[model samples]
Target: MENIDKRNRLDEAPFQYRINKDQTVFIDYEGKQVKILKGKEAEKFIKNVNAAENDKAVQLIMAKITGNFKRGNERKKR
Candidate 1:
C-alpha cells in the first residue's frame, strides 16, 4: 500500500487513498476505491453509495479527493 497526504485527520477525513501493487493510486469512498478497476467500478459506485456505511459523509468527502480521478475535460472532444 502507498501513502498519500490527507486533507483532514483520519477521523475528520472522508476519503482514503491507497496505492495498489501495480503502483496506481486509488481513492476510497463509499466502500470502493477509484483504483485500477476494469469495468463497472464507476457505475457500481454511483449505484451503491447509499448502501455504504459512511458516517462522516464519505461520499461528500470523497468528492474532494479529485487527484485520484482523471480529468476528462482536459482532453479535446473528438
Candidate 2:
C-alpha cells in the first residue's frame, strides 16, 4: 500500500520528493518516519496509504508532472 498523508494531498506541495537508494521516505508528519516505494513496489504502497486529503495531494502532484489532471471520462469531453 502507498503512504498517503495530508501533505501529499496539497496541490502547492512539492511532488518530486528526494529519491533515496534505500527506497524509504521520511515524511515529517504523524511524528514518525514513513516509507515511499517506487516502480512495481508502488502498487502495494497505494493500498496501505489512504487519507482523503492526502489522496488529493498525490493527485495534484501527478497532474503537475503530467501537465494535466483530467480523468479518462473528463478528457473525452475536451
Q: Number of clashing residue pairs in every model? A: 0, 9
Query: How far does residue 26 in candidate 2 sit from its true spot (Å)?
Result: 22
Whole-model lDDT values for every prediction: 0.47, 0.41
Candidate 2 lDDT over 1-78, as tens digits, reads 235343434444434433466654333222323335566555433433443256555544333433433243532213
The 10-residue segment of model 1 with minimum total lDDT is: 1-10
Put down candidate 1 lDDT per residue, 33-54, tens digits, no spaces: 5544323554444444556566
**What is the alpha-carbon lDDT of model 2 when measured against the actual structure?**
0.41
Q: Please give the RMSD to the true structure for each candidate, in Å.
A: 12.4, 13.7
Off by over 4 Å in 2: 1-53, 68-78
Best by lDDT: 1
